[model samples]
Target: MKTFIASSPHVARVNRVDSIMLQVLLALVPGILAMIWFFGWGLLINILLAATFAVAAECTVILARGRSPLPAIADLSAVVTAVLFAISVPPILPWWMTLLGMLFAIVLVKQLYGGMGYNPFNPAMAAYVFLLVSYPVAMTNWLTPTMLAEHHLSFTESLRIILDGSLPQGLSWDAVTSATPLDEMRGKLDRDLTMDEIRQSPLWGAFGGRGWEWIAGWFLLGGLYLLWKRIITWHIPASLLSSLLVCATLFWAIEPQTHPFPAFHLFSGAAILGAFFIATDPVTACTTTRGQIIFGASIGALVYVIRTWGGYPDAIAFSVLLLNIAAPMIDHYTQPRVFGHGGKRG
Candidate 1:
């Protein structure tokens, strides 16, 4: 008898990317509901528009590459990306603009970089920055919270406004929408208003603002669920929020009128969302625990610096993308000691 031996390749498996992405989508439910309660159906239309375009664009790009489109689109990554992009955008963006943003995210940002795991940047954030730079007026037209704003539009009217870029009588949605809390604060500071003066406005609420704080709270809940599920580590979130608090407190102590409160900075704009979701993106973020903390802290510090002195009122996208560039170096330097090995290098 002759014995023949051959080495077999090792294959390791876990849940598919689709399942993880689906889990993220599920976690967004509370935040989505809160947005609808405050912002109305405009966000719904934006989600649908961005999601549809994302899936279509991904499929189309995959097919162009002679790959299976179904598998790529089925992974639900496109869905998550679309939702993130949609939520980051102003509720009143014209349908065509929304579509263009989705296409840029799905094609240029994701596919052009060889798709999901290989992309160096968070696709939705990149798309958001693109839209913001190109369409500043449209991007900043955040709607007034339902509780505070006088008029609210129906779902049908929202759909019409999003698709056509105008309400009845040729007025643009921008005319009715309210300024974001960050915008309001920056503007008031420029006009030499103190923090007390800014807070006295109906625009600011306890902790954060009328709609902004609730949205941030809802997203924080979602992030906690993700933590409970073990989908993400706590290091990133802790570092990001802690950095923000320290920076905010230091500045507020120096001059109260020049800086907003720490709580307000923590809850306003995309601070919580970026810390919990966007900055934690495994592909674009650091892999090791220490590295993740450093990456997150870098993002938090940049966000504060930019918001205080840079051109934009909210700096989450810029911060995240900037840190994404340094993630590789962060991972290299912060590599943990190998288990059970002597406390020294090989």
Candidate 2:
């Protein structure tokens, strides 16, 4: 009998891409359910449409690349991208727009970069920025939360509005849609309204906006669950939130009348979501622990700056994309020293 030699230090790995992606999908459930509860069936519609489009796009790209499509599709990365894009967009976004964003995410952002692990930017966020720039008006047309709406749209009505751009009788786009909480705050501040006066609006909640705060809370819960399961490390999220809090607190202290509180920053828009899901992408984000902290802190600070002074109301997508470009450099400088090495080498 001949003995065959193999590579040294063989180890069994338990985690798979599909399994990790499945957990991420599970983690999104709390936030998704909360959105549907407050926003209505339009969210569900966008999710279904985006997911379908993403899978189709991924398959098309994989086949064109002369690779087996089923295995790539099975990893569920495209599905995750689709869901993230869906949740980020306005719930009432048109079906065609959703499809277009998914196609951009799956094909141009993901596949064109040589599939999942090769992309430098978060695909969903890149798609979001693309749509936002290309269709600013449509992207900003967020529907009023169900509680705030004068008339709650039924499933069929929401579907019609999304698919056909048809408003129900006696309803107009102005009547149904409103600025997001972040946008409302920016607009109010631009108009020189005091924070207290702005908070008096029904849209304002204990920390962030009424329905939006709770949705962010659910995302936080899901993030914590991921942390508990060891699906993600604490470096990125902790650093991101802490840096954001610090920036918000410093600005708020400087001008309490003009700036919202730190808690408001945490719970408003996509701060929490970006910290956990978008900023923590295994491929695009920094791999070293210290580098992750640096990367996340930069993103957090940029998010605050952009939200306060940049052109956009929510800055997560822009912040993450910017930091994605820096992650490799961050990792290079922050590489950990090898054990028992005599000294650090350049």
Candidate 3:
């Protein structure tokens, strides 16, 4: 064997797009499992339908462009987008809605913009926001955690609901679906209830609503895995979580009765997932070290501000998308110095 010594480290083949996407899917397993544990089979069904439609849409578009779809399909970007969008919506969302979102994600948001690396917006979040805007009722029809659910839906029942968008005669929508934790917090806080009063409901557990906090922990675990694997650097996630924690602590300290504890902010909604997976998207997020910090900080701050006073309960998609639109500007101002240069490009 020939000796191949070099000062620089060798780039591992595992960094290929398909391999990286596979690693991401593997990282999502624990969190996805936890979600299924709490919410039931609807999430799984949603994943399957979204993946199917995403692949189909992507393939159709590639063929329309006079290209073979297999190579692109093997990269698994469409599946990643599908999973992200699927998990963001209600598990009981109708099949047609899933198809629409996938088409918007794969064809419109992604391929139309010149596909994967060339796309400026995160396709998943864009499709999610689109569906949320166009169909708010279906988008927000979240099921309460099974521990606190009035009725535990069977897999067949969940499948039927997603496929047909109907419930059994005796089963009312109000009986099966419940407001998400963020929704609960917003609704109760808007009604002038103290944080303590809101915490007393069976809907709550340690730091957040029942089951949600633990799901955040699992996602955090997955994020750590990604960091350890070197698939992602720590700059974005570290800054994002730190900024969010600081904001949460400051506000909670000022008014404990009105604001939630820092832990609650960290553990509830999509904070953990967004910080690690969504906000750190390679294409849409900042590139330079300083730019990444600023990008993450902005997202974290926006999430808190919007969730507190803006129309949405959770603001990850909105915040990330807004920052995505501004990423080029951020990088322009925060570029690292060149070896012989004293300052960044003007």
Candidate 4:
């Protein structure tokens, strides 16, 4: 009998790009359902539209580059990017804008940067910033939650509004759309309203915005599932939330009247989602454990600074993009020593 010698240490490789991407899609379900529940059918429409556009764009780019589209498309990275961008945008965003964002995300940001692992910035976030910069009005026109809206448009009406920018005779944009919770808080703070005064509005919930925090909670639950699956480590999410909480607590502690509570920072907007899903992208984020901690913390701190004083209402996209650029350097500096490496590299 011949004995075959394998490598010294062999481990089963159970994770693949497709499997990982599928898990991410599954994790997003709870959050997506929550969003649809609160915001209505527009959310569902945006997601489908964006996903379709993303796959189309990915195919086009791959064919243009002389590659078979099937393999690239099978990975589902494009769909993940589409879902993230769609969920991040205003539910009432026009169909054209959704298509435009998907094109930019897949073609310009992802493929043009040499595809997938080579791209320095998170494609979803890059596309979001692109749309926000180019079409501020559409990007900011978030619909009022179902409970708060004076009138809820039917599916057909929502479709018409997104497709052709048409509204019923009796309704105006202001009647259906309202500022997001983050936007509302920023506006109120700009007007010198105290935190107590701002919380008096029906928009305010126990921690974050009415109906919004629940969505964040669902995302949090999904993130925890990801962590438990070992698909993602806790370093990024843990450090990110900790840094944001520390910053928010410090500021709010110093001036309770001016700063919102730490829980508000954690539960509002995309803080939890970004920490778990966006910032934890394997290709664009730091790989080393220590580097990931630093990378996540920097994003968290930047989010706090920008939300407090930057021009934008939420800073997750901006902060993530900024950190994505630095991830390579972070990995370089924080690389783990090779197994039997000397104490010094002399």
> All models: lDDT?
0.89, 0.93, 0.91, 0.93
Candidate 1 residue-wise lDDT, 1-346, digit = tens? 9998767644554556877787788888899899989998999989999999999999899999998998888889999999999999988789998898989988998899999899999999999999999989889988889988767878987888898765856455554688899999988899999888888998778888888999999999999998988788999989998998899999999998889889999889999999888998888999998999899899989999999999999999999999989999999999988888766666
- The residue-by-residue lDDT of candidate 4 on 1-346, one tens digit each, is 9999899558876898888999999999999999999998889899999999999998999999899999889999999999999999998899999998998898888899888778878999999999999999889999899999988878888888889999878998889999988999999999999999999999989999998999999999999989988889999999999999999999999999999989998888999999999999999999999999999999999999999999998999999999998998999999988887867676
TM values, all candidates? 0.93, 0.95, 0.95, 0.95
Can you tell me which runs of candidate 3 are displaced by over 4 Å?
1-12, 343-346
By lDDT, highest first, what's the ranking? 4, 2, 3, 1
lDDT at 244, model 2: 96
- Per-residue lDDT of candidate 2, residues 214-284 (tens digit): 99999999999889888899999999999999999998999999999889999989999999988988989
RMSD of each: 3.3, 2.4, 3.2, 2.4
Stretches of candidate 4 off by over 4 Å are 1-12, 339-346
lDDT score of residue 112 within candidate 3: 92
Off by over 4 Å in 2: 1-12, 340-346
Q: Is candidate 1 or candidate 2 better by lDDT?
A: 2
What clash pairs does model 4 have?
A: none
Rank by TM-score, descending? Answer: 2, 4, 3, 1
